[model samples]
Target: MTAVLPERVEVAIVGAGQAGLAASWHLVQRGVDHVVLERATAFHDWQDRRWDAFTLVTPNFQCRLPGFAYDGDDTQGFMTRAEVGAWLGRYRASFDPPLLEGVEVVGLTRAEDGFLLRTSAGELRAAQVVIATGGYHRPVVPPLGLRLPDGVVQVHSADYRNAGSLPEGAVLVVGSGQSGAQIAEDLHLAGRRVHLALGRAPRSARRYRGRDCIAWLEEMGVYDVTVQQHASGLAKRESTNHYMTGRAGGHDIDLRAFALEGMRLYGRLTDASDGVLRFAPTLAQYLDHADSVMESIKNDIDAHIARAGIQAPVEARYSPVWVPEEEPAALDLAAEGVTSVVWATGFRPDYRWVEVGVFDGTGHPTHRAGETDVPGLFFLGLPWLSTWGSGRFAGVARDAAHVAERLAARAGAPVPA
Candidate 1:
């Protein structure tokens, strides 16, 4: 049986995280009547799943939303998960964002007026819909085709809480991104023998060298480069550097250095049986090649600075920093008695519930800024929406503001102020 539908609004924003919140703020500033739908009770879904020690790789200054900034002494200090969540909560309260918490949007379809949105709470109609759900909602797990022995325990990085959550044995962390590296380091510190599967070492930024890389990218207009301008799809994808290194000097966790000290550096997990995980020995070699690519980028940046005669102290300091180009030594997990695997392979956005036809061959919506092929339908908080920083807390606001402006110009019935 169908439930009674509720009143309609000008716009319906989905997801109450940073992206959704920014959208709502922009709409409010534009004097557009709207409502926000959220599945969780509060913002930051990762907050519930983040381990106790987790902190954002991007500093708090880069974590600001539109109309507000992080009020703290240490602008470059990375905030813990709890601190971030609290800040988000405070932001929500300050703006009194029209957020309907605990409302799960089950379906979205075009309506005669605009769109009909079905949620767990009730049904509502809107002239336009903005899908602001970030990319981390779905966790990517290991491929099902890969056979694993019944004795081997596997958990996605989302399910991981702490080192104690692992089974009583040595641990194998698959993936070398920030999450994978952090988890591997944590497990090793917890007295568990850890083996990290090498995928590709990402290009890491030196966070503490006076000026943060994110700020530099913003100033240099790196994010403004469009996908169309790049020569190739691979070139476009490789343009941005996503890796973040620890800033606390020698004591900080360096996955590359840690791997060199004895953590296993298997290329990839092919198959596992009889409590044995098989790895490609060439994994370390590939990682070395990846590291060289990063070094080249850094060197290029330094060369450009020298040619431009930029004698700023920060620029001078940035030139001499060394990015290593070697993979860590491999350690045998079986010898150390580690017995579990954690897949931190990242996430993929699923839009099965979004019944729109704007998706491309890759199942992602094609858009400029946040505009979609389907009129009145838009998206925000995507990996790279408008600029390189578009998805970040600081970057999302401008994109959202642009989207709200477009929405205001549409010919729809005025929503009650």
Candidate 2:
């Protein structure tokens, strides 16, 4: 029996998220013939997983795809999950990229011609390959659940949709990053007793010096910081999620706020068995660290305003979330009547699909900008690939364009003339 060969194209793009769409945009503009293979119909996998009140941390203006920019009036404001999904969907419709939906790339092998992508639909050979699956991949949930009783309800943040979906009881949200903090708030606001496990994160005031902290980051080129400037690859791989909410013009989302709202606060979740959770003694340090980061951000923003001679409003009435005492390093979830546990722990890329050995020790693609170690292979959505925003909303388009252009230049881009 002979194995069947796959259909070939100039380029094979994996994942139809923001990064993939951006790459598709540039490839089409350059007249390159390509196919964007998407595992899901909707462009955003994380967006669909977000809670009901989820919104982009970046502003609307930064909601840019490859060839299109956000044209709505809420450029400075944040966009909701539905709005972003709709926006990306619209962008997909506007382009003529040969995109196949509901097609999962099960395996990618380096072929003699280019690369062979084994997908649910069929196999495809391409001169170049672009992995634009965005940063968020498989959820990173701990195996502590195996020790717990069968009655406990546990779901990672990626699997979480809203608070209403959970059982009627106190909720325990692990991980204090953006998702964890935000979901804790969601559950708390939904009238459930919430317990938030504190994780290390750099937080900021929703508005610093009368402008959004994100605006300060934009003006200061903070988002453009590259991995080269970072201390190490590990530092570069660190999460940039801020402890702030994108709701109602954005606001601070400190563990302190959740604490003040009567949410039980615990430190890093460590071990769990028989419904008992052990935690690290780091909640106080987390609070102090969050405060320090926020202050540093404010000082930097203030310095930028003064140095740039930018007129800003004077500090008026200030409302601060009161920092509360940290919880003990142990939690009795079963006794506390906590029926639901939300592992807002975030995701890690599952590269088992890619046959290429391009991953570093940190599990990220070893590439300069978007070009990988292999000649024609590239990556677009790793954090700080080109800038701090590379793995984020702002950097996806730019990085995608860069990677697409590189692939095009290498192949003399077989765009339709």
Candidate 3:
């Protein structure tokens, strides 16, 4: 049974995921009375949504929340989905903040004093509100997906579990993001013929110069790049997903690697109609773009090593490899035995609960470093809110601290005073 929320709170945090918990820890330390509301019971997304064999793309070193950090021996290693869930469970036990689970927030309106929130449990008011719901909410699938044949099974990356769950046939994994790449690899390794639809996403090596690329990035403070301090205007936008996996303690997961593993690669999925699938014929171009991005990152790492005077052993540089599709622009899925489709496009922000004018045309909140134009209104755990690590556990503390400070100031209780 859901408990009735109090009439008012000093601060109210919605979505008790990593971001919400991090913000709650900061508020509790300052003796601020706040409540974290979560629609689900668990604290991390990996606990429920990801596949059984899923692990983090980056190493375990980046799994540091505000008051908690992974102290296991696998700092240089990637964490499996189960390991991540255990870490979050431990964090919940350690702090045990005032979190109300199974409380779905249905509506939020601006009250005269602060704000009014109508939830599944009950209605409540809050002087300050922090939306820690990270950006990945709604899956951004192309409308063309609905055009697939009725017999072809369709599932989004979030709903997929393992290769065994899929029917025995040629599977087409659409989108070349991290999930798509890893899923394709999983199916192929399971002895199933897989087809990958390529996109222009960046890729990263699992290790560089004998040291984990994640550690190298940390040493060079690459994750500390804030929106304003980024290399270019475009860099201020959200960063693309990495292409590394924890299989065999992590390895490069590029398109060429997948092809070498007996997986067929194709260009981006353009359309599907009348049992015919169309591809964009940009496979080579997409490969070149990804290769260029990887090269640039490696160059930066190399320059950083040289500047630090580290006597690290040199590693062979990556060479651009391409695999072209031999098939024509359009093909029949039934003819090729393709029976299932996995869409790994991406996600969009969902904020239908909050009835406010602060949102932009794209439904993205108009904020400067998590602070909205309205007083006592802030956001947390958003990508690029402050730095590259903003949404991840490694970088959430910085943004949480900033959000707490701003919230305190708005309530007439200045923090760090």
lDDT per model, in order? Answer: 0.71, 0.80, 0.82
Clashes of 2: 3
Which of 1 and 3 is ahead in lDDT?
3
Highest lDDT among the candidates is held by which one?
3
In candidate 3, what are the lDDT values of residues 1-417, reduced to their tens digit? 757688899899998888888888878777788899998875657766798789888788788887789968988788888888888888877788899888888988888989988999989899989988788898877898888888889888988899989888999898887888898888888899898888878888878887888788888988888777877643455556767687768988877867777787778788888888898887788787787777788898899989999888898888756466563477679998999989988788899888988888878888877889988888887888877877568788788888987776666664554
Candidate 3 local Cα displacement, residue 60, angstroms: 1.2
TM-score winner, 2 or 3 = 3
Candidate 2: stretches off by over 4 Å = 1-6, 42-47, 232-234, 316-327, 414-417
**Candidate 3 stretches greater than 4 Å from native:** 231-239, 325-328, 412-417
Candidate closest to the true structure, highest TM-score = 3
Ranking by lDDT: 3, 2, 1
Can you list the residue pairs that collide in candidate 1? 169-338, 170-337, 170-338, 170-339, 223-388, 260-328, 264-331, 267-283
How many angstroms is residue 389 displaced in model 1 relative to the true structure, after the best TM-score fit? 1.0
lDDT of candidate 1 at residue 83, scale 0 to 100:
78
lDDT of 1: 0.71
